[model samples]
Target: MVAAYQKLCPETLDGACRELADRDPALDRIYRERGCPPLWQRRPGFRTLVQIILEQQVSLASGRATMKRVENAIGRVTAQSLAGAGESGLRAAGVTRQKALYCTLLARAAMDGELNLGRIARVRDHEALDMLTAFKGVGRWTAEVYLLMALRRPDVWPAGDLALAKALQAVKKLPVKPGEDVMRTIARPWRPFRAVAARMLWQEYLCRNRAASAASG
Candidate 1:
């Protein structure tokens, strides 16, 4: 898939820009200002989903720390290891109580053959979402993130993301950050490459925020 992305890079970026520009004129300016970030490649299978679970509601650095502890302690991020780990052990590995329970449930489900990671890759977005969200800790956001980052699905969008909302608001000169419905409407044209647009928006957000901070400083 990474190889395919490398091959299709030009078409992908061009297509994304065309769609975004068609959606709103400001998207052209944002694209010109921000350019593209490194393409996010997925690590195949359950480890990526496990990492996504660890990322929920936490800073990326903190999530990385927690993931590192989990990996070091359990030697694998499989459902079996997560299910087998004692509560004390998981707590020591930096998992929150809620997350620990979720992880345990996920592990048990996987071990019991209830959740099949391999089969997930073959399904469409809605089906994939349904399959994953059936698990204890996996919600719409987490499942969407998994599909976008891990599955490398082109059309996926995280409308619930506050950062995406802010980016859209700033780029489109909206009076306030758009809610999910507005975002969905604004993002419609970007369809298949919405994920790429999302990457561009995030880059724009970081650049603008940094500039603002520097100016204030």
Candidate 2:
């Protein structure tokens, strides 16, 4: 059963990309131009969850910087360390007050044994998502990202991700970014490999934007 939905490693990652490219021309173009996307997997643990929470509604770089500050402030980014830091320490470490509260609540949940990150890994994707979203700060986007990146679930699609919207627009050559429902519709053909499709779009988004930035600068 564990093998039924195994995490995607490098070999499987490339396979998924090939399969997805066969289905979508835009994704095919991404493979032709950018090569295979990185697995971008994260460790399934409290620290990574905290990092995802920091990423909420913020740029990925900003989220990473804040997470680094959190690590600097409290050494290891454990539930215990974050709990000790509390909201004030987190805010001092460059976390916004709202996010600090969210992190504090998450830390409390983990420390109290309410959230079992290990147990979550053994469960199905929907169950894992439900377990994670049970926490205060872990919304659908956060939970789905954790599933995609940390759990390495092959099929998970994160709805309402701004980067994804932008990437979809750029790749599909739409006049504007897609809305959530439209994104859902657009993503349907990539079923069971939507996560790989997402990786491709993200690559397109980042590389295209970076090139545009360089040209302008």
Candidate 3:
């Protein structure tokens, strides 16, 4: 079982923001301007995992739209419903063929009792990641995202996330976007609260882009 300390809540998120801001001026600016970033916690289960799969390699808005389509196609996103919908149904619902295969694979695993969400919740962080990634189409990024958003694991960082990379580039004022290795290295100092730091950077990224779009419009 995950320790209480390891699980992030709204209070801990704010505390983490304060701690991080005290150490980094860029993070401080985010807290001062944006306030504490939203907890953005997702429920831990099969449905949330599939949503993360949909998000892979796509814009968040696009991913969300596709998820809504899936919900419209199937009554709900449970393992039974998804399996019944099959790859063709998912593809017709706006999922790419590749992602359709992935969603089907996950549904089969869950239905067969091979992938237990309860077990995943009880396991250690690395073990949880390993179990999630054991299935095809669940890569490190997918698994990390599940831990960070769904499980609310305090330290998990998705170095492969494009938004976080862009935010890092902007916050650090780098000439180019950071590669995964560079991103990991830079994030190391944030330690047990790296996930909160990620939220802060994401806030900066989204707000800045929204402002830019507003200005352009």
Candidate 4:
């Protein structure tokens, strides 16, 4: 299933929007307000999960740089190389101390066959979340992001994400950022396509926050 979804990339955002808009009027408005950004599909594998771990609490640029360094040092971002890397070496690659440990743990798990990322696409969202979070460095938000973006699961949402909360507040005209419980309730209607909704919201956020968009640009 993972392989099949990976094949679906190069999937046009236009098609996704049309389908989503047909499913929900509110989503149509969102698509009209902000054109969907191209889906940033990632290659599936241990290295990809390692990169996700690197991405926690950091800017995308920083994460990319750190990944590049790690890749260069090891010649490949595989479990074996990462597990063999010393803490000082990982730190030199710009990984935080905690993240380095997480990466190492993830690498070891992958090498030992304890983690089976390829199997996730066959499971339900809740099961997938549980399976992913069993890994040392993985949590709900990380797993959800992986499911939504990487696995291309339609309904997954990372309610804990501050960016998504703020985006929802601005787009929905909320008086304040919605808490996780509130977000879950509000997001229910977008079910079965909430991942698409998430993409739309993030795009709306960039459009509404020009300064942030420019900075990221």
Backbone clash numbers for all candidates listed: 0, 0, 0, 0
* For model 1, the run of ten residues with the poorest summed lDDT: 1-10
- lDDT of candidate 1 over 1-217, digit per residue (tens): 2222322255565565656656667777776666655566677677788788888888667888998999899898777777779566788888898888788778788888998988997887889899999998998888988887777777778888778888888888899999999988988876667777777787778788899999999
Q: Given candidate 3, what's the lDDT at residue 2?
A: 24
The reply for model 2, stretches above 4 Å from the true place, is 1-4
lDDT, candidate 3, equals: 0.91
lDDT of 4 by residue, 1-217 (tens): 1222222343544565667777766668887766665576677678878887788877667888889988888788788899889566798777899999888888788889888888876888899999999988898888888887787776788998777899888767799999999989988876556676788777777677897778889
Worst 10 residues of 2 by lDDT: 1-10
The regions of model 3 sitting more than 4 angstroms off are: 1-4
In the order shown, what is each candidate's alpha-carbon RMSD? Answer: 3.3, 2.0, 2.2, 3.7
- Candidate-wise lDDT, in order: 0.77, 0.89, 0.91, 0.77
Each model's TM-score, in the order given? Answer: 0.87, 0.95, 0.95, 0.85
Residue-by-residue lDDT tens digits, candidate 3, 1-217: 2233558988888888888888888899889999998888899899999999999999989999999999998978999999999999999999999999999999999999999989998888889899999999999999999999998988888999999999999989999999999999999888878888988988888899999999999
Between candidates 1 and 2, name the one with more favorable TM-score: 2
- Residue 38, candidate 3: alpha-carbon lDDT: 82
Quote the lDDT for 64 in model 4. 87
Question: RMSD of candidate 1 to the true fold?
Answer: 3.3
